[model samples]
Target: MTDVVAFLPGNGHVDARLSFAREKAQRLDVGFELRSVDYGAADSFEALLDSVLEQTSGADLAYATGIGGLVYLALRARGALTDQRAILQGPVLWGLETRTFPKLMRLPLMPRALTLAIARGPIQRRFMRKHFTRPLTPEFQRVFFDGYRDARAFERWFAWLTPRLLRDLEQQLRGRPELLDGLTAWWGGEDHVVGIEELRRTEAALGQPISVREFPSWGHYPMIDEPADWTAEVARALAAPH
Candidate 1:
């Protein structure tokens, strides 16, 4: 039996989607606990990392999906987490850094203001939905909507997503290839939120080969899109020898 810790996506808390891990654990007759770092409550990436470390101190393995995967990588790179093996689903590596903005939005003051504006309910909902290749169920809709409505949360998220932070993260990962030694990553070919280019960049930055599984039709949220497949991957990771 293995004790597993699952981290929620960037704007999410522990929710029903994580129940798939619980169910998988039961079937495998292994120990499993789902934990969350409240990204909404964090004032910055440093605070978010602190919360994750504080919350998930004694787990045997880490399971992180979406941006949470990236968070796990950051925590591991910083030596904040002790988990020997990690399962990362749809990790958002260099996507944030490569995001394109309109010429007008690039103007001073307009960028932050426009980001804040889009972080509001209606626009945020539309933007969040764009991450998926297919439509979301009602349950996921509520989850996404709730995340979008938390304006302060978006503020903190944006604040932590600066170019400086990206550079720091790259430097940390490149400087310590051992940080990514036991990671297994899953990526969706259809994922609009994180591109293959980002995955390649992540591999390059790691300075070593990484175990990655690619699903051609899956989108950004594979657990939501295909829970059974996601759970199966988790089980495989759990069963693999570290």
Candidate 2:
């Protein structure tokens, strides 16, 4: 499989996460590449991820998380196995009913218009910038906002798709039974977005040869929280030869 599994980044995240992974591959002396979708209104997350992996010569793994991870699982659950393998890092296995969902959008009383308005405005970026462990480096700040600012174009074009992100997630966890078996990552002791108990229960429910670690120190953005340490593990995980 082409070099190694590629990494698909989460929404609006800039270079730090995937770049950290590249450093890991170099240290491990493994053949691998770190690339992510060039975010755009024209490309759905899965379409972009699938295109990247399809260009490879053989089966290869892909590492993805959050909505990004759900995109990969959506394809696998749908029976489109283009990649040789997939490695889910704290995947969005379930629990996305409120984030971006079609059913909720269909609900007459859902305040989606207001939500989208908030997300499209500076309000969302301000909130995002606040959540990071560190302020986004000034350089990333420019590029990050540049892309985020253009999200209105997408909101107009993909209005219906906004809620579907969460629906896609909930389906994989509840409707699809094929998501959990392939690969793994550290669960959590008290994950906020993805709880420790739910993660473990999801793994057990799948009942397959999956590997996971439980770390209380890290949260959802484990790579950002402990890049060097997580990268070391990811490097070894990739070297194992899927």
Candidate 3:
């Protein structure tokens, strides 16, 4: 029996990662597993590698769902991960510069920041329906709030990362070049995290139209927004090629 593994950065939500894989697995009639990088387990690079080697095993294919995982996919394409094929999804191109160093100009950030703060603050204990404490998704609020006993324990669990994360992100922003030369990118137009234009630019800069898929109304995490459609496209792409 063939299996497909879905991977993500440890800080990422398990619900989101598994939701993407399990939905697609059901559609493709394949076995699925959720693997996560363990950030807490590594203080240095060598230790990080050992941890990744321990957790990430080859599969029929691995769906690399975010910037951290997509970077790993490109490295895997170059033979770092010799045992599996990788699918890149909604990859973040400029993280340190665009995402964290400073907020992007045209988007709303204060709301998100406040949302996160209130979600984890003292008010969280008393205000179930308070505006600041509530999340975008009513059903998912508990998944994030109640899923972790405390933030510290949740952050330490996944101790491995797909090896390409920092290196690729570092290189690309330095204007080194496109790492997508031999990789396929899967994206959606409605994805707020990585815009459609960014994906187009990446595909163009790579000098080829690698595979691209778009959806309507589904933001960054379309697997959760539009599961059935995402599943259909995923099955088709996995069956296509490296």
Candidate 4:
């Protein structure tokens, strides 16, 4: 099967993003069976990764965003996924350093209940706003709000952000350096969610150079903010020899 699996971000859904990916795949006439994985309702990080692995087991290509990219990398490392090519957009590879969280939220001593409360309350708006460089459209507002209000989803999200996940990711990358092969990274210059320096650190950890495409004007969600550019980039990556 010439399948392509699209992995959504933490607070994301298979709506406009997945539609855009499907549209691009159709436009390219690549005969890809496009599918999207939803992690919003997952109970934990491992559960989310398990769902992703199961969904994309037969995929030949994969597209992932934010933390979803990390999930892809982990699967690739574990030999759970054997996709020939992967397109990672603003992947959260640098662990906690890649994100901009409040000092209180990052504290190891912080209660999970307090963190969940903050995520569901005042911090939700800020968190959503950080993903876009422009104003929120009605559709995105609905998606963001729905995800933010789901307490269980926030718990899963927070669970993925812990230091243990970072350590595990690093070990995986180190153990399976081949995970970085046949991967193209797309990063937004104005992205507030991921740091450039941290990306460099991740590259060093991989011990290989990653092909990266930078969109200076776009934020975290380039597919939503710059669909044409994102599509063209994917097409180019797909067209390239593996």
Model 2: weakest 10-residue lDDT segment is 152-161
- What TM-score does each of the candidates earn? 0.76, 0.62, 0.60, 0.75
lDDT tens readout by residue for model 4, 165-199: 66776777774656667787877899887756656
Residue-level error in angstroms, candidate 1, position 112: 9.7
Residue 212's lDDT within candidate 4 is 83
Clashes of each: 0, 5, 5, 0
Evaluate model 3: give its lDDT: 0.49
- Considering lDDT, where higher is better, how would the candidates rank from best to worst? 4, 1, 2, 3
lDDT of 1 by residue, 1-242 (tens): 55656564654344555555556656755545556545546766787788777765676667676566767877877876644677777766666566663234335666457645754667756865777665656565665555444534544554555566667877787767677767778778888876667677777765666788888988877666666666666666667787
So what's the TM-score on candidate 1?
A: 0.76
lDDT of 2 by residue, 106-190 (tens): 5563444645454553665674455444445655445554443344222332333344654554455554445444556555443
Please write out the lDDT profile of model 3 over residues 197-222, one tens digit for every residue: 65555444434465665555555665
Which of 3 and 4 is ahead in lDDT? 4
RMSD for each model, in Å, please? 4.0, 5.6, 7.2, 4.1
Instruction: Give candidate 3's error at residue 90 in angstroms.
Output: 1.3
